[model samples]
Target: MKNDFTLEVYSENAFSVLNRMINIFNRRRIRIRSLLATELEADYKHGMASFKLHTTAEQLERAMHQLEKLIEVERVVRIN
Candidate 1:
């Protein structure tokens, strides 16, 4: 069975932050189906990034854990 997972990451608006997030997927050899980034707050430029990937439950959990560990990531949420 395949599961589609969405990772919502809140972090600073910077290219390094985005690059780090993409590296997580690359290192896992997971292909991201979609990636969206937007500013959450205008003043601070807090960014929200959503990544969609289809994979097994175990891999999804691992990916979430890795993403949460990033210093720039303020929060991580898993979406069905």
Candidate 2:
């Protein structure tokens, strides 16, 4: 049951954090459909990244849990 899911990640401007986040899906061979980034704060190290991809619910759950564990990640939420 693969369906589209959007993951919104609130994180700092480490940049590396973004790579790690993408690696979560890349390691599993899941291709991200799209990605958008926006600045949330005037300071340098704060922003949000939105990722859209298609995957099974079970896999998404695991990926979300993993995303939350990253030190730079402030929050991770599903948009749909």
**Which stretches of model 1 miss by more than 4 angstroms?**
none
lDDT (Cα, tens digit) per residue for candidate 2, span 1-80? 89999999999878688899999999877669999988788787698999998899889999999999999999999989
Best by TM-score: 2
What are the Cα lDDT values of the candidates? 0.86, 0.90
Q: Candidate 2: which pairs clash?
A: none
Looking at model 2, which ten-residue stretch has the lowest summed lDDT? Answer: 38-47
| Error at 69, model 1, angstroms | 1.1
lDDT, candidate 2, equals 0.90
Model 1: worst 10 consecutive residues (lDDT sum)? 37-46
Tens digit of lDDT per residue, candidate 1, span 1-80? 56778889998777689899999988988879999988888685689999998778888789889988988898998877
The TM-score obtained by model 1 is 0.89
